[model samples]
Target: MAGQPTYMLGNRNKSSRTRDAQSINILAGKAVAKAVRTTLGPKGMDKMLVDSLGDIVITNDGATILREMDIEHPAAKMVVEVAKTQDDEVGDGTTTAAVLTGELLAKAEELIEKGVHPTIIASGYRMAAEKATEILKTITIDISRDDRKTMGKLVKTSLTGKGAGEYKDFFADLVIDAVLSVAEETEDGIQVDVGDVTIEKREGGSVLDTELVPGLIVDKERVRPNMPKKVENAKIMLASFGIEFHKIEKSAEIKITSPDQMQMFVDQEERMVKEMVDKIIASGANVVFCQKAIDDLAQYYLEKAGIYACRRIKKSDLQKLAKATGATLFQDVTDIRPEDLGSAELVEERDISGAKMTFLTGCKEEKTASLILHGSTTHIVDSLKSALNDALCVIGVALEDQKIVAGGGSPEIELALRLSEYAATLKGREQLAVSKFAEALEIIPQTLAENAGLDPIDKIIELRSQHEKGNKNAGLDVYTGKIVNMLENNVLEPLRIKTQALNAATEATVMILRIDDVVAAGSRKGAMPPGMPQPDMEM
Candidate 1:
C-alpha cells in the first residue's frame, strides 16, 4: 500500500498527456482556422451562421463568424480569441489573425512531428513575430491627417470584400467626415474615440441614403404635443432627476382621512413639480432631456413655458449629448446653472419613417457625430453597420498612428520575404520555425488568390518574384488576377491592423503549442444529485 502510486486526479477526470494533448489541441486550432479561412479577402465568401434559436447571420467578417460559432474545444476557442483580440485592438483583420494563427499551428505541427520540442518552436515563433513587426514598421508609409484622399483609400480598403463594398466611396467620405469631426488633439497626439461616432440604422431606403450628422441624434420626441417642435440656438439641459414627485425611500403610508386633505396633498404635489420645471427654465435651458419620468403636471407646465422636453432618455444618450453640446449632466435640478447648459445651433423633432426622432445638429463644439444608415432589410442594414464600423475604426487608427501600408495582401507578401531573409541569419532549428512563420504568412495571399478563383501557387510565385525584384508593394489584384502595386492602386490600411493581427496570431499559436497536457472533468449535465437514484441504463 505504501509503494502504490496514488491517483493524482479524481476518478471522473480524464487527462491527455504530452504528445496526445499536443496533437488534439493543434488539430483543433487548425480546424478553427479552416472554418474561417475562406472568409479572408476582397473576393472572400460569406458564411451563414444559424444559432440554436433559428436566427441567422450571414457575413464574411471573421470576428462575427467566429463569435457566432459554438466552439467546444478549448484550443479552438483560443483561435476565436485571436480574432476577438484583433477586432478589439484594430477593429479589422480578425480573419487574417485567425487564418494566420491556424497556419502557424499547422507549421508547428510539422516541427513537432520531426522531433522538435514545442518550446523550441515557440521560441522561434516569438523571434519570427518580433522580426515581422520590425519588418512591418520599415514598410509603412507616413501620411498627414490633412491628406483626405489617402485617408479615404484606407477606409475604402477596410470596407471592401463585404456588402458595403459596392458603396465604399460614398461610405468612405461619410466615415472620414464623422471621424475627423470628433477627432481631438492632445499632448500625446491625435486621439480618435470611435465611440463618439454613433451609427443609427433604419430600413426602407437604399444604402446611398446614408448621411452623417455633425452632432447627435436621439431616438426620442418632445414629451407633449403642444411643445415647440423645433428650438433654434438651443440651450440644452441634461437632467438625471425626474420631474415626477419624489417617493419616500422607506415603505410608508399616508393617512388622507378627508376629501379636503386629499385635495391639499394633490395641490402640494403640483407645486413641487412646478418648482422643478422652474429650476430648468431658470438655467436658460430652452430644451430638456430627462433621464427619468416626467409627470403629467410637469409636462403641462413645461409645454406652457414653450420648452421642448423629452422624458425617459437613455443615460448613454444623455452623456453623448453632453459631449456634443458641451453641456453638463445635472442629477439635481437645483444644482443646474447657466454655465451648465450646452449649446446647439438647432434642436428639431423630425418624422423619419413615420416615427418621431430628435436631431441635435451644429453643436457648440464638434465633439461627436452620428450616421443614419438606410437599407432595404434589417439584415442589409446590420451588415452595412458592421462594415461601416470597421471602416471607421481603421480610419481612426490611421489618423492616430499616421502610418499606412499597401493592402490587397501586399504587406503579407512583403513581410514573408523580409522574415525569410531574417530567418537566414539565425542559427539552429529555430530557423526552421522562423522560415515556417515566413511561409505561414504567405497563406494570406494564397487564400486571397484561391477565393478569387486564381491559381494560388502561380500568384504566390509572381508576388515573391516581384518582391525579389524590389517591387515590395506588388500585390495580387483579386479582380483582374494581376500582380500590381497596391500603393499605386490606392489599396491601403493602417499599419496597426497588420501589427495587431500578427501579435495576436503569434500569441495564440505559441500558447496552443506550449500545451503538453489537457485534463477534463466529467460533465455534470445529467449527473444525479447526491443521494439521488441514478437513471437505469440497462435498456
Candidate 2:
C-alpha cells in the first residue's frame, strides 16, 4: 500500500529532511553522552567550560557542563534537558541520567535497524523503566531522619568529587543545617524549599571563612551614616510603604499669593514624611527595613530617632526577614503595631569585602537561614556553590522521602542484574529490547570505573559476579577499584534521585526513539544582516 514512506514521497523535501531520524538522534545523544561520560565518579575529571566572553568554569558537574555548553543539535539539546530535569528534581545524579538516556537510545537504535519498530522499542523501554523502578525499591536502605552522622555522610558522598573534597565535612555540616532549618513537615511528607536558604557570595577571604548565619543577610548598606551602626535587642520593622512624598501627578505651577502660602505648601510635604517616621518610632522599632526608598526627610527624622534603617531592600530579603524574625509587613506605615514588628537579638552592620552588610542575628524563627559564602576568587566560590546546592538538594530529598540507596554505581548495577533476570521472563522482540535496557544501565558502573582509571570491563564483570553471589549492595569502589559494600561505606543517595533519574532518562529516550523524521526550515532572511548570503545548509 506504500510506494515509499510519506517523508520520502517528495523528492525535494526528502533530501532536506532527515529520513533516518532514529540514527541521527541516537548519534547526537551518544555525542552528548561522551561529552559528560568522563565526569562520573570519585576520581572523575573536571570539564573546563569557556564562554564567548572568555569567562571560564571548571567542574565535573553534569548540569553545569551541559548548561555552559553551546549545543546545536536538537537531539543533543533534549538529552541536555534530561540532566536539567534530574538536577531540578533530585539535584544529583545528573550525569547518570544523561548517560543512561544516551545508552538507552543507542541500544534502541540497534533494535530499530534489526527490523524492530520504534513503537515496540519505546514500549519495551517504558516497561523496563517501570521494572527498574520496582527493582530500586528492593535495594533502597532506610535511613533514620534522626541520624545526622549518616546524613552528613550522604551529603559528603554528593560532594566527594565535586572539587570540595577537602571541605566536605565542613560544607556538609552547613548544608545539612541550612536544609533542616527551612524544611517543613506537611501532611504528605517533609517539604523543602531550598530558596529559604539564602546564599550570598563575597569574593574575599577563603572557603573556610564561610559560615551560616541564623537569619537573613542583605547586601544593602545603611541608608544614612548617621543611622545607628549596631542595635542590641533590635526591634525590626518591615514597611512596604514608600517612605517618600508622592509627587503631584500633573506638572503645574501653583500661584502663591505670598511666600507664606508657598512655605505652608512646602511644610505640608515635610509633615507627611515626619508623620510616617513618627509612626515607626511609636512602634518601638529600633531598626527599619524598607522595600522602597526612604525620603531624605524621613531619613533625617529616623536618624534623629536613634533608629537604624536600610532602604531599597529586596523583596526576597523582606519576606525572609518576615519569616526569620516573625515580623509582619505593613502596607501602611500608620497601622503598624508592636506585634507587627519583628525582633533580632542584635542587628549590626558588618564590613564584608569592603562593603557594608546588615546581619540580623539570633532570630526567633528557625524557618529561614543564610550562608555567607567566601572565597579568594569567584571561580572557586561559584563552583563551590554549585556543589553545595547539589548536596543541599540531595539531603532535602533524602529527608523528605526517608529512604536512600547505595551510591558509587551500586544501584545501577543491581538494577541491571534484576532487570536482566526479569527480561528473561519476556518473549519476542520486546525481550530483546528489555535485555538491551539491562545492558544499557551498566554504563553507570563502567563509566565510574573508567573515570577512576580502572579497567571498566574487569570492574563490570566483578560487579556482576558479586551481585550474582547475592551481594545486593555490592558496587564499584572507585578508590580501591574493587567490588565492595556501598552501603557499609556510607556511599548513599536519595531514593528519589534514582527513581527520578529513571523516569527522566526513559522519557527522553522514548521521545528521541519515536522521532522518524526531522524537518528543518531554512534560516530566516531577517536573522542575518542584509547582503549576507547563507551557506549550503543541511539537516
Candidate 3:
C-alpha cells in the first residue's frame, strides 16, 4: 500500500495528459478557424448570428462572427482572441488571421502525428513569423497622408466584400474625409484618433443620403420646448454638474410645524436652481451640454435667457464636444467663465427621422467629424456602420504608418512564395514549419477563389506562376477569376493590417501548439464526475 502511487488529482477532476490534450486543443483551435474561413475575401458570405433572445447580427466580418458565437472550448476562445486582437490593432483582416491560424494548426497536426515534438513545431512557427514580418517590410510601398486618392483606395479595399461594397466609392471618400479631419500632425507623425470621428445612423433615408458633418452630432435635443432651437455663434459650456438643487446625501427628516416653513424651503430650492442658471448665463455660453440632470426651474431660466441647452448628455459625447469646440469641461457651475466656453459657428436641433438630435457644426477648432449614415432598415444601417468602421480604421492606420500594400490576397500569395524560398535555407524540421507556414498563407487566396465560385486549385496554381515570374503584386481578381496586379487595380490596404494579422495568427498558433496537457476541474454539464460509480437502473 505504501509503494502504490497515489492519484494526485481529486475524483471530481478530469484530465487529458500529453498527446490527447494536444489533439483536443489543436482540434478546437482548428474548428474555430474553420468557422470563419469561408467569410474571407471579396466574394465571401455573411453569417447571421442569432442569440438566445432572438436578436440577430448579420455580417461577414470575422471578429463580429467570433464575438457573437458562444464558444465554450478554452482553446477555441484563444483563437477567437486572435481575431479580436487583429480587429483592435488594424480593424480589418480578421478572417485572414483566423483562417491562417487554423491552417497552421492543421499542418502542425501532420507533424505531430509524424513524431515531431510540439516544442519543435512551436520554435519553427516563431522563426517563420519573424521571417514573414521581415518580408512584409520589404514589400510595403511608401504612402503620404496628403495622398487622398491612395488612401481612398485603401479604404475602398477594406469596405469591399461586405454590405457597403455596393457604395464603396461613396463610403471610401466619406471615411477618408472623416479620418483626415480628426487627424493631427504630431512631432512623432500624423496621429489620428478614430474615436474623434463619430458615426450617427438614421433609418428611413437611402444609403446614398449619408453625409459627413464637419462637427459633432449629439443624439439629444434642447431640454425645453420653448428654448431656442438654434443658436448662432454658439459659445458652448460643457458641464458635469447638475443644474438642480442638491439632494441630501444621507437620510434626514425635517419636521415642519407650518406651511410657511415648506414655502420658504421651496423658495430656497428655486433660488438655488436660479443661481446655477445665472452662472451659466454669466459664462456667455448660449449652448449648454450637461453630463447630469437639469431642473425644470433651471430649464425655464435657460429658455428665458435664449440659451439652447441639452441635459443628461453622455460623458463620451461631452468629451467630443470639448475637443470639437475647443472648450473646457467645468465640474462646478460656479467655476464656469467666459474663457471656459467653446465656440461653434452654429448649434441647431434637427428632427432626424422621428427623433430630435442636436448638431454642432463649424466648430472653432474643427477637431472632430461626424458621419450621419442613412439606411432604410435597422439591419442595413448596422451593416453599413460596421463596414465604415473598418474603412476608417485602415485609413487611419495607413496615415499614421505611411505605408500601404496591395490587397485582394496579393500580400498573402507573395509572402507565401518568398517564405517558401526562405524556408529552403533553414536547417532541420524548422524548415518544415516555415514551409508549412507559407502554405498556410495560400489559404487566403484559395478561400477567395473558392468563395467566388472559381476552382481554388487552378487559381492557386496560376497565382504561384505569376509570383514566380516576379509579379509580387499579383492577386486574385475575384469577379473575373483572373490573377491581376492588385496595385494596378488600385486594391490597397495599410501595411499594419497584414503585419498585425500575421503576428496575431502566429502567436495564437504557437501558444496552442505548446500545450501538451489539459486538466479540467469540476464536472462538465451533463457529464459524470471522474471515478463516480454508474447508477444501475435495470434492476
State TM-scores per candidate.
Answer: 0.93, 0.89, 0.94
- Model 2: per-residue lDDT, tens digit, 1-539? 67855433222222212335667678889989989999888888999999999999999999899999988778899999999999999899999898998889888878877888888888888999999998898887777667898899998999999867779988988998889888898899888888788888899998999989877788888899978899999999998878988788999888989989999999999998888888888989999999998999999999999999999888888988898889999888767998888988888899988778998888878677888888888888888888888988998899988999888888888889888889899986788889999999999999988888889999999999998999888988888887899988878889999999899999999998878666544334323222122223332
Model 3 regions more than 4 Å off: 1-7, 523-539
Model 1 over residues 1-539: C-alpha lDDT tens digits?
88987657654556667887888888888889999989888989999988999988889999999999888778888999999998888899999999999999999999899999999999999999998888899889998779999998998888889989999988888998999998999999999999999898888778898989887999999999889999999999999998889977999999999999999998998888899988888888899999999999999989999999999999999988988899999989789999989999999998876678899988987778999989999889999999999998998899899999998888899989998899899889899999999999999999999999999999999999999999989999999999999999999989999999998999999998988876656545633333222222211
RMSD of 1: 4.0
lDDT of 3 by residue, 1-539 (tens): 88987667665555666787778788888889889988888889999999999999999999999999988888898999999999998899898889989999999999899988888888888898898889899889999988888887887788888999999988877898899899999999999999999999899889999999888899998899899988999999999999899999999998988999999989999999998988888878899999999998898899999999999999999888988899999999778989989999999999988889999999998778999999999999999999999998998899999998888788888889888999899889988888888998888899999899999999999999998999999999998989999999999988998889888988988998888766555565534344222322111
Checking candidate 2 for backbone clashes, the offending pairs are: none
RMSD vs true structure, all candidates: 4.0, 3.9, 3.6
Any idea what lDDT model 1 has?
0.89
Candidate 1 regions with alpha-carbon error over 4 angstroms: 1-7, 520-539
Would you list the rank order by TM-score, best first? 3, 1, 2
